[model samples]
Target chain A: MEIFLQQIINGLVQGSVYALVALGYTMVYGILGLINFAHGEVVMMGAMISLSALTALIGIGLSPLLALPLSLMLAMAGCMALGYGIERIAYRPLRHAPRLAPLITAIGVSIVLQNLAMMIWGRDYHSFPQLFANRAHQIFGAIISDIQLIIVIAALCIMAGLMLLVHRTRLGRAMRAIAENQHAAQLMGVDVNRVISITFMIGSALAAVAGLMVSANYGLAHYYMGFLLGLKAFTAAVLGGIGNLRGAMLGGLLLGLIESLGAGYIGDITGGFMGSQYQDVFAFLVLIAVLVFRPAGLLGERLAERA
Target chain B: MSLRFVGSLLFATLLLAACGKSATDHASNLLTVRIGAAAPLTGPQAHLGKDNENGTRMAIEDANAKGIVIGGKKVHFELVSEDDQADPKTATIVAQKLVDDNVSGVIGHLNSGTTIPAAKIYSDNGIPQISPSATAVAYTHQGFKTAFRVMANDAQQGQALGMYAVKNLGAKKIAVIDDRTAYGQGLADEFIKAATAAGAQIVAHEYTSDKSVDFTAVLTAVKAKQPELLFYGGMDAQGGPMARQIKALALNVKFMMGDGGRTPEFIKLAGDSAQGVYASLPGVPLEKMPGGKDFSRRYEAKFNQPIQLYAPYCYDAVNVMIAAMQKADSADPAKYLPALANISHDGITAKIQFDDKGDLKGGAVTLYQVQQEQWQALETVGAQ
Candidate 1:
C-alpha cells in the first residue's frame, strides 16, 4: 500500500545516512580495532561548522548556490583535519598501550569534543537555512521531498566512490594489507600508521556529509544531534558485522527499514498498547536478534574479514 | 593546559572565598539577598531558560537600583543561577545546592517535571519558590506552600485550546501527538478531554520523545487516519520539524500545537511551512498585558532581542516575590511566607493573585495563528 511505500522511502533516506556514518565506525574498526567514539562528535562538528560557514558566506553576499557547495567542502576539509588530529593525539599516543586504554581514551575524546562544541555553539537548536526551494514529489500516493531524494542519491554515489577507492587503488591495497596484519603490512613497507590515518580521514569526511544530510532533512541542528545517531549507526555496523564494508551498508538500510516500519505500525501491531514513543527499541531489538542468530552477521562469514 | 587549569582553580577558590565572606558579613550595612534560580541553561531549551534568567536578573538589577531596605537594612539582591539541564534528578541536586548556599528565595526549574520534584526540596528548606513557565496541574495540587507559578496551568490552557479548535476552527476529527514529557502528556490529556467532551472525534493519538528529530513514521501513521486537524503537545524543537515534515508528506490537514511551539524559534525552524499553524499559550498577548508595552520595550532595549514567550511572566514572578518580602519587612523566607500567601500585586501580565492551591487565579489563555511567519493573536479566553 501507499503507507508501505512511504515507509520504504523514509527508510531509504534515513538508512543512507546511517550507512554513511556506519562506514566511519567499520573502517576504523577494520584497521585500528578501535571504535573511534569521537567520530560522532566529528559529525556534530561538521553540522556546526557547515552552518557557520554557510551563514558567513551568505553574509558576505555570495549567492546561496555558490555558498552551499563551498560550505560543504569546507566542512569536509575541517572534519578531515579533525580526524587526523584526533588520531594523532588520542589514538597514536596510546596505540601501543593496553587495548582498554585506547577504548577509554576514545570515549574521553568524545566527551571533550562534545563539550568543546557546546562551548563554541552555546547549546541551542540552530535552524538550518532552507538551501533551495523544496518540492515534494508524489509516487503512488507516497511523497518524497527533493532534499530526501538528494540525500539518497548523494549517499549512494559517495558509497560507490568509496567502494571504488577501497578496491581499485594503491592506497586501497595498502589499507587492506594493514587491516589484514599491521605487522605484515609494516614489514611490506605499507606505512601502517599513514594508511590508518587516511582511513580515519576518509571516514570522517563521509560523516561530515552524513551530518549535513541529517540536518537538512530535519531542518534543524544542535550540539547533541550526533549522539543518538552515532549510537544507531554503531548498532547498524555491528548488526551488519563490524569491519565489513558491504555488510555495514546492508545492515544500515535494513535497520532503517525495520525502524521505520516498526515505528509506523507499532500502535496497531500491539493493539494500541504501544506507540511510536517506543521507536528506539526497534534498532536495539534488531541488533540483539542479529547478534544472537548470527554472531558473524549477515554476509559476514565469507568476505574480507575487515574493510 | 595544566597551567590554565591551575589558574582557573585559583580563581575559583578566590571567588568562593569572597562569596563565603559575603554570606557571613551581615556585619556591614548591606545585606546580600541571594535568589537561587534553577533552569536548563545548556540544552535545546536554553533560549527559554536564558530568557527566564534574564528576566530574573533584570528584576534583581531594578531592585538594586531602587536601594530597597529590608527590616531597616540595605539589601543588595544577588542572583545565584544553576543549570538544571531540565532533568528532575539534576533539579533536586540544584535545589539542595541552593539550600546549602542559603539563598533567600528560589526562582525556577522551567519544565513541570523538573519543577514538581524540585518544589519538594525548596519546601523542605522553607524557601519560597516561584515558577514562571511550568503549567502542569499536578504542580499546584501537591500541597507545597513554597510552590507558586505566574502562568496558567494545563487544565485551563488546554480547555481554552480544545474549545477553540471545536468552536472557532470547526475541527470535527482530530489527531493528537505528544512528546511524552510531563508537560506534553498532561496538556494533551486535558485537551483531549475537553475536545472529546465538546463533540470532536479523536481519530489517532501518538507519542514521541522530547529528543525526537524525525516524525515521519508517526505522521505517516496519523495521515492514514484522515483527520481534519492534527495537534501536537511538545516543545518547539520537535514541533518545528514536525511541521516541516507534515508538509513534506503532503498531509493536507491543519496543523496546531501548544504553547511550547509558539516561539520565534519554531517559525525559523519550520520555515514557510509555519504559516497557517495555530498554537495556544496561557497568557494574553504581550501587547495586551496591563504594563506589557513598557515592560516589552525595556526588555528589548536591555536584551537586544524580542521577548520570546514567558519573559513577562518571569518578570512578574520576581516582582511578586519581592513584593512579599517588602510587605513582610524581612528577607527571611519564614517571615515572608504569610505575606506571599495573602498578597496581591499588579504585574506586567496581569493583577497577580494565587488561589489556595497556589494556582494563579483567573489566568487567561491566548490563541495564536501564524501569518507570514509571525505569530498573530486570535483571541484570549478566561480572563477575570
Candidate 2:
C-alpha cells in the first residue's frame, strides 16, 4: 500500500510535466489546426537557453535565486519568438496549400532545429544547477522534493493561466473563433494570421516552462531530452482528444499514473523483471488501448476536425 | 629545326636522371609508418571519440619527435583517421576502408557494440586492432586473435564496485539498476551476483532505458526496499539524473556506479546531489600515476582540453601498437599480428600485456568519490 501511494505521488509529479507540455501541443493544434512537430525542439531550445543563462549568471557570481527566474523568462521569450518565426516562415506560406504540406514543413523545421541545436551545443549533456536542492517534505511515508512541488504547482498555475487567457481575454476569443471557423472568423475581422501567431507564441512559452522545470528536476539537459518528453506529451494530447485543453491535462496525469502503477505493482510481481525499461512501451500501450476504446479520448470534444 | 629539338630532348633526359638520383637519396632517408584510428568523430559519442583521437594524435606526434626506429630505419608514424559514428555498421565500413588504405595497425571503435562487429572485419582482413575503452567481456571472447582491449572488462569493474560496496562501505542491503544496454546489463548482472555473494541482500533490481529522464517510480520502489546502497550500472547521462532524483527524494542511501559514471560531466549533471556518490574507474587519477603527470601536461598542451576518461588508455593503445610495429619491423598486417601477441610495454594506463584472448592481464581499478564537485581518488584495487 505504501508502494502504491509512493508510485502515485511519483506519477503525479511526472504527469504534471507531461500535462504542461501536452497543453502546448493541444493548444497549438486547436488554434492552428496543424501539428507543430517542432514543438519538441522548441522545448529543447528553451532548456538550452535557460541553462546558458544560469551558467553565465552563475559564472559572473550571481546567486541561483536571482538567475533562476530570469533565465526562465529569457527562455520563454526566446522560445516565443522562435515559435512566431517558425509559424511565419514554415506554416504561413502553406496555410492555403494542402494540409500535408505544412505537416511536412513542420517536420523539416524539427530536423533543422535539432541539427542546429547539435551544432550549437555539441552532442554532450550539460548540467543545470539545482534550483531547489536538498529540500523535500515527507507526506505519509512518501517523500516529495521541493522541486517536485514547484513543478506541480507551476504546471497548475500555467494551466489555469492558459485557461483564463483562452476563455477570458479578447485574444482568446479571437483564437477560439479562428479555430471554430477560419473563414467566418476572418470575415468577422479576427486577423486570422495574427491570432494564429499569438497561439504559437503562447504554446511555445508554456513548453519553455515545462522544459525549464524538467531540467530543474533532472539536473541535466541534453539536445535529445525533448524527444521522449515530446512524444509523451503528444500521447497525452491524443489521449485527451487533441485540441481539448482540459483533456490534455487529464490525459497527461492519467498517463503518468498508469506508467507508475504499471511499473510498480506489475513489475514487483514479476520480481522487477518487468522493470521501468519498458515504461515507455507501457505508456504507448495505454494510449493505443484508450484510442481503440474511445476514438474521441476521455473528454470527447469536436473542437477542430482537421487536426 | 627537328635536329635541334632532338638535341634538347637528350639534354633534358640527362638532367632528369641526375634529379631522380637525388630524390632517391631523400626517399631512403625517410621511412613513414601509417597507423589508422577509427572512432566516432561526428555522433552522439563524439566527445569521447575526440578525446581518444587527441590522445592518439599526441602519441603519434611524440613518437615522430623521438624519431622512432625500426630495423635500423628511422620511422615516422602518421595517423590515418576515420569516423565510424559509433555505429556497428559504420564501424565495419570504416574497418574495410582502413584495410583498403593499408594501415599498419588500427586503434579504436570505442564502444563495444561497434568494436565487436568491427573486430571481425579487422580479423578477416588480418589487421591488428586494439580498442582503448571497449570493456564488454564478450568483446574478447569472440576468439579473434587480432582483437585486443586496454581496459578491464565490465565484469571485473562491476565486481570491484560490488566488493567496495559490501566491504568498504559496509552496506548490507543494495538495490541495483541498469540502463538495459549490453554494457549496462552486463555490469549490473556481475554486480548483483557479487553483491549477493558478499552477504548483501538483493533488495530490488530495476532497469531503465537510456532514453528515460525520470526514474521516480523505480526510485520510489527501491526506496520502499530500504536498501543501504543503490548501484547503477549506466553511463553518466542516465546516472547523473538518477543521482539527482535519488537525492531529491532524500533517501539518505549511498549511491555507487561503475566507470561509466566517473566523468566530470556526471558531477556537473548531478550538482550537489553527486557530493557523496562513489564510482569505480579503471585507474588512479592521472596526477598520481607514474608518468601520468607528463602525459597530462603533453595532452593538455596538444589537445587544448583536459584529459577525459579513457584518454590515457587510448594514448597507451597507440604506443603499444607502435611498439609492436617497431618489433615486427614491417607495416604488413600479417607480420604485425603475430608480433603484437607477446608484446609488453609500460604505458600511461599500466604495464600493457594481452593474453591469448586479447584481454589485458591484471589491470588496476580505482575508486573515486565526488567531493566538492570533483572526482577525488579514494583507493586503488589491483586486478586479482
Candidate 3:
C-alpha cells in the first residue's frame, strides 16, 4: 500500500539520523566505559554552531554552495574541540575516582552545556532556513522528498566510511586495543589518552553531522533539542550492545522503524484506544524489552568479551 | 572530587542568588507598589511572553505618567517580570516569587497549563491574577476567586471554530489533532463535540506532544481517513512544522488551527505552506476592536515592533486591575477584589466585564485565512 511505503520512507530517513547519533554514544562507551551523557549536548552545540554559522554566512550574501560545506566543517571542528575539552576537563579528572563519579560528572556536564546554550542562543525555536532544493519523487504512489533521500544516502556513506576507518587504519587497531583493556593497552605501549581523545573527537564529529541532519530534517532547532534525541540514541545504543559498533547501527535503524510503524499503525492495532501520541512509548518499551530478554543486547559479544 | 565539596559549593551560590531578590521597603519615601507579570519570558513562547510583559510595562508607564493618587498618596507602580518558561512547574515557582515580592496584582502565566497551577498560589495569597491568552476552560472552573481573563475561553472559541468550519467553510469530515497540552487537547475536545453536534462526521483523532516537530506518521494515518479538513489544537512552534509536513506529504485536506496557531511566528515557520490555512483567534480582529487602531499604533510606537496577539488584552488586564484599585480608593487587593469582580471598564479589546466565573462576557471569535503570506480576516463570529 502507498501508506505503508510512505511510512517506510519516513522510517528510513529517521533511522539514519538515530544511527548517526548512536555511533557517538557507542564509540565513547567502547573506549571509556562511561555513558558520556553529555554527548547529547555536544549534538545540540553542533546544531547551534552550524545553524548560527549558516545563518550568518548566508546573511552576508554567501552563496549556498560554499556556505553549506563551510558551516558544516566549522560545526564539526567546533564540536570536536568541545568534545576533547569536555573529556579532558570533566571526565579525565574523575576517571579513576569511582565508576559513579564519572557518570555523575557526565550528567553535570550535560546540564552545564544545556544552560550554556540557553545563555548563548536564548530559548526561542530557530527555524532552519531552506537551503537545499527538496524536490519530491513519487515511487509507487509514495512520496520521498529530496532532503529525505539525501539523508539516507549520506548516512549510508558515512557509516561505510567509518567501517573502513575502524577496520583498515592503525588508529582503529589502537582504539580496539584500548577498548579490550585500557591498562593492558597502555602496557602494550599504546597512547591510551590520545586514542581516547581521538575516539571522542571522532564521535563528536559524527554527532555534529547528525545534528545538522536533524535540524535540516525537522526544519527547527532549539536549546533543548538534544535531550529527547540523546535519550532515544542511548536507547538505540543499549538495544544494539553498548560497546558494539555494528550493533548500534542495527539498533538505531530498528528503533526508528519500530517508532514510525508503531505510530502509524498503533491506532488500528489497539482498536483506536491508543493513538500516535504513544509514539515515544514504543521506543521506551523496546528498550525495556531488549534489556529484559537479552541483557547483553542483540550483538552483545563485545560487552561479554570485555567483561 | 569530593561530592560534599561540590554540593556545598552549589548550595552557597544558590543561597546568595536567592537572598539578593528579597523584597526591600521603598527607600525613595514614595509609595512604591510592584505589579507582577509572569509569562514564558524564555523558551519557544518567549515572543508571546515578552508581548505580555511589554503590555504590562506600557500600562505601568502610562499609569505613572498620569501620577494617579491611590489611598490619598501618589503611588509609583513598578513592574516585576518573571519568566515562567511556559512550564507548569516553573509557573508555580514564579508565582511564589511574585507573591514573596509583595506584588499588588499579577498579569499572567501564559499557557493554561502554567496559569492554572499558578492561580492557586495567587488565590491563596489574595493576589489578583489575570491571564491575557490562556483559553482553557478549567482555569476559572477551579473556583479561584482571584483568577480572571480578558479573552474568551476555549469553550466559546471552539464553538465558533466548529460552527464556522462546517457552516461557512463547509467541512463535513474532519480529523482532529492536538499537542496533548491543556490548551491544545481541551480545545480539540470541545471542537470535536461541537462539530459532531452540528452533524459533521469525526473521522479520526490524533495527538502529539508540544515539543515534537515531526508529523509524518500521524499525517500518514490521517490521510488514509480521507478527511475533508484537519483541525490542529496547538501553538505555532509545532504548527509551522506540521503545516510544512502536511504540504510535503501532499495530503488532500484543508488545515485549520485554533487561537494558539494564529500567530505571526506560525506563518514564518510554515513559509509557503502557510497559504490557505484557516486559524481562529479568541477576540475580534485588532482593527475591529473599540480602541484597536489607536492602541496598535501607539503600542508599535512604544515597542518598535507590531503587536503580536494578546498585547492589547494584557494592556487591558493591567488597566482594569488599576481601575479596580481606583474604584476602591485603595491599592490593597483585599480591599479592591470585590470591585474588580463587578467593575466595568471600556478597554481596547472590548467593554470588559466578567461573569461570576471570571470569564469574559459575550466574547467574540474571529476567523482568519492566510492569503498570499498574510492573515486576512474572513469573518467575525460570536460577536455582539
For model 3, residues A1-307, the per-residue Cα lDDT tens digits are 9999998888888888888898899888887788989988899999999999999999999998899889999999999999999989999888888899999989999999988998898656677888977789999998999888888999889988887777678988888888788898899999989988888999999899989988887787788888878888888888988878887888889888888898899999999999988999987798888889999778884643321
Q: Per-residue lDDT for A58 in model 1?
A: 94
lDDT of each: 0.87, 0.82, 0.87
Q: Model 1's lDDT to the true fold?
A: 0.87
lDDT ranking, best first = 1, 3, 2
The digit string of per-residue lDDT tens for model 3 on B282-334 reads 88899989999998899999988877678889999999999999999987889
Question: C-alpha displacement of B256 in model 1, angstroms?
Answer: 1.1
Stretches of candidate 3 off by over 4 Å are A304-307, B1-29, B291-306
**Model 1 Cα lDDT, one tens digit per residue, B1-384:** 697776565556444643431232333565678888888886678878888888888888998999988877887788999999888899999999999888888889789989999999999989999999999999888899999998999999899989988888899999999988889999999999999989999999998888778889889999889999999999998899999999989888999888899999899889888999999888788888999999889999999887877788888888899899999998889999889988899998998999988889999999999998899999999988
Question: Please, what are the lDDT tens digits per residue for candidate 1 over residues A36-100?
Answer: 88888899899888899998999999999999899999999999999999999999989889899
| TM-score to native of every candidate shown | 0.94, 0.88, 0.92
Off by over 4 Å in 1: A299-303, B1-27
Who is ahead in DockQ, 2 or 3? 2
